[model samples]
Target: MPSPEETVKLVQQSMAVYVKPREQAEHVRRVIAYHLQSTVEGSRPGGPLCLIDASANISEPYQGIRGATQEFFKASAANSKALEEFETVRKAHTQLNQPAGPVIKPNRYEILDDKLHLINQQEKSARLGTLERHIDILSEKPATNPDFLSLKPIFKDLRPLVKVPREIVDSLAMDENADRRDLASLVEKLDKVLLKSKLLLTREEQYLQTLKSQISLDPRSVTPSAKARALDTTRNELINWIESELSKASTNADDSDAGHDSDSSHGPSTSGEKPGEEDEVAKKTRQTIMTKLGTVKESYQLYVAARKSLVAALKEPVSMSARPVAEPPVRQPQESPATTEGSSGTASYLLLPYLSKLSELTAAQKAVIAYKSHFNVALAKQLKEACQIIDHLVPESQLLPQFPWPASERAKHLNPGSLDHLTAAVSDQPDLSSQIKPWVFASDSARIATMETVAESIEDGQVGIESINKTLTEIASLFGEVNGDSASISQGDPWADLALDLGLLGPKPRP
Candidate 1:
């Protein structure tokens, strides 16, 4: 019963109520709870009514999010009536030029599922995403050395890996208390070693700085080569220790063949002790360990490189030279279009076809927007969507989803004699090579099929104010100025004006 504007305002207000992107499930739960509460009370707040429609169904979109909970997605079959009128509210979002996400049917989970707290799906999902993101951030070229304070929060998160809470362990059917405790002890050792390594790295850096300063002030105070060797030996010992600790991670018979890697992509290949007992928590803990170990290893390598570079510079002194005078840059002359560049210059305009079609699509969309009560609005919308779809089905990308399209199946088999004959015949027929080509996704086939469908729809039209072509012609005619002057476009239909200028359309009829 709400207006489109009211619906959009409500949707924004509800979604804007400070829900994290990953916490959308909790948001949905709250929204549905609010909906039920408000419905019973007959009090509609601007908040929950945002995502609600005339049918009162909520839309849940989970794809593309890293740790999205699939179990929470609302199924439509539970309520057929609710989703039928949901599109009106969604259409209002489109009117505002914003995506309303997917409009799915509300499922029975809202009423049936009371074990929400026991399941930890949303919380686990959000935390897993955070862990993965942490790994990813570490993988990138770090701006600064990995600090202990920053990782303190992560260590707290990793605590679950060591000590599984009684409630979670009971619900998830975790390993026996003894085995979990052993695994916890091993992880706790690795964490302690890592903390020690961070402290050791800080001390080594300070030591290196002192050595460099002593050598710079008194050339004979310290041997650059000796100091560099000592620095590397200590760092390598610590690095190897970290590596050895990581290598001790539990490996099952099946997973024993896997390699221990510092790369986040191959995060913690080995699981906890007794792989049979290892759950998602154990796996995540190992991954987080590997990620931290990886950062430490990287810091070590960086320190060694910087120390070595500084040592090498100290060993070899370079005499300063005068700077060379800079020369002015020479700009090349622009080529004229009249010159025959042989497709080199023209390749940039490959998107011109899509651009032209897009122009027409925008005009059609605008026409529909201006006259919402247009007789052919539905047809126009279909055409607009089809045009957009067709535009995106670019060359070679939109291949008919085929599986196991092997080399033999993909290649056309022709005899040597037949090939020779065909090649000879291609001299007679210039288009033969293109006609009898190897397998590839055809560009024109999809466009033609889509155009044919549009053509059929235009023909049927359910009887338009003027037929489809008549409307287009009427639109085109608007570009024709008074006294048949093609110089000035009268009604401002750029497409029509373009067609007239290009001589694609005939002269307009005189009034």
Candidate 2:
């Protein structure tokens, strides 16, 4: 009998020498292919091992000769056993060459599902245990504890499950044996778990509500038709209301004016009127009424314009009105000297009485009077000096030469006091005093000095100490009242004596 290695060598040598080299290579290739094929096939459950057995047969082939060959056959059998062992090892090598099962890739979802299943199983087991304990307690006697009272329902619910253990049921039937305290504690724990579950459910509901509210507030949530209708309705209502109010106001104004006219015409009856006196009074009253009517009409137009502007401002699609530039207050023409005498007398009468009776004059009134007196005196002085300068500059004889001779007696009689004479004189000499008037009488410095004097006098109470100091605070305020360009004292300057004496300034300490 040959060893497994020797048998293998014999098989190789026979194939190399007896067989053609191509045939031998082909047979070796077939043997290797068959081994590989068998390995793949053998790996499967209950697959064939014939290709592996065939390789063993080739390694230890049978020889010829009855007795000698019989002995050789027995040896060959033994060798075949060793060869089979070698074939087994060769088969293992081929198996190692075979592709393995798909590489074990991790399936995340599968892992998660497995974990969830495990958790569910654990929860079921715990719940079942709890149920079993509850049943065991109930089986004894009914527990008096409140905790056991809660467990009674759980045990009752599991009554239908026949798969429950008989021992658990028997224990539950003898439940009075269990401590009442233990049962109550279990009930409390279960209540806490239920509370946590309810809280989680509430939080989920709140999250959904928040999402819904956010969606509603979005501008896109409103329909176009709804927004358009709201705008249109508001605009129409505003226009209609404005029109109605305007009509009512116009009617009221017209009625009031008509009433005033009627009342003026029908003057109060009295026993003192002469025959034609009534007629003259009536005519004057009618003219007065007509004048008042014109003023009323102008005021009414202004009111209407203001009302229109307000209405337009209030409208939904707010509109603006063209603002009218306010006209400056008109200055009345200066009266002639003769005419001024009467008006000034009346003005003085009206003002002087009121002023003399006043216990305390306002700082403004004191300032005004001081300004007026100062201006009048300064103006009179300037006029006299101007007349004197003109007299010195031009001789009477030269004046006539420079000026035109009068064409008529009226012209010759022209005096400096008369407006006509002044006009004629100016006309005669185109370059008369008008050209040098500004230089001859400068008012800038004098006006400033007068203002300063007035302000100082008002502060120091130079005019009336008792009266001005009574309102020293009020007078001090006047310093602030004066505008930037006007005469204003420094912040801490003492009040003038004249101003304090006049009682135009506020109260001060007694001297």
Candidate 3:
């Protein structure tokens, strides 16, 4: 039995001698670096000698070189002055060995041989053939790189190999069997393998779920070629369904309209009416009348409602205190005498037929009219009182001159000249005189009443000078002032002569 140090040295010696191929040297260097960083001495059952190879073709090699390397590393310690020269020599050697181009590639056979060597080293300590078989299966490549078909068998072998580490092996003979003595090792190895398998399965399941989800959401389905046809069919089906629903909705809407028409045509029967006895033609005529009446009522109500709303909207309260006091009412031009004469002519012409109708009235009608005379007398008295109040408020000085009265151009046909002659002609007949008298008196009474009211306001001295100035200002704003540059006329003051000329009273004398 060789010592562990001696075994490592012999292995390194065999590698350097018989396996002196270019690729072999590179692989040995990498393996050496890996073991130096990883393997602990005397930790495993076989100690450091477990990582060695002993085949019948190769002679037993010593592990003294590994021991020497370890010794060399320890010799160059900190605070040792001689170690600096050794480091310099080591660095120079590493620089000289560095290749100029990329690292050399290893042959496939060399790589396989290296893997076999690793397997042989592991097998020396324990029968780990399952692991070796797994590596062999992974290493074989088919002609076409073995598409998806080759994955099944590889996965099946890998699944079993992952469990081999948990198999109990005899400590002395290294036989595969669970023994109480190796139970702790078996459990630890089992735990590690199970944990690795669990992690792998978890990642695989996540990957599978992602693949399945991607396939389901694919717009092209599983077959990319059918994508265009599928889209067209889906669009046509949606349009057909929409058209069908629209037709059904339109049919329902028409039925609803028919029901509404029937209800409207069969207007509600009155209290005593029976449905069957009602004539269809008469019912239609009644419906038409009711519809017209309803339309008229609706229009009239709308007009009333709109007028009320407008009146309410415009009824803004005026602040009496803020407003200047009311001035005497200004009188406007009266209708000319010629206008009155023309009005009499037009009135007589229009009333001729009414006078003819009055004569046809029975004597009983005239007797009934006389019976209502007291009511007409009371109305006349009330009118006279209103006229008195209006006459007291206005004054003559504020009145406008009577001129420019309106008369129809056609009035000349009734009277070529002398309006008095035309008036007398209309007044000659008793029936015509009675009819035209009221119209003539109504027109003259309005003018005389206006004149009387203006005369009363002037007598009461209620005329507003500010009102006159405001009126003058408004006129000036529209037509500009008579003399804007005059020395007496300020920015907004009225013309001094305007009040006198317009017959407006001058400013009230100061108290």
Q: In terms of lDDT, which candidate is strongest?
A: 2
Better of 2 and 3 by TM-score: 2
| Structural similarity to truth (TM-score) of each candidate | 0.15, 0.13, 0.12
How are the candidates ranked when ordered by lDDT, highest leading? 2, 1, 3
> Whose lDDT is higher: candidate 1's or candidate 2's?
2
lDDT of 3 by residue, 49-151 (tens): 2233222222224355566345423332321323344456558756766788899788999999999999889877465677777677877755436565676
lDDT score for residue 81 of model 1: 37
In order, the Cα lDDT scores of the candidates are 0.52, 0.56, 0.51
**lDDT per residue (tens digit) for residues 241-279 in model 2:** 554575576678667666755654564443344546655
Error of 3 at 317 (Å): 82
Question: Per model, how many backbone clashes are there?
Answer: 2, 48, 17
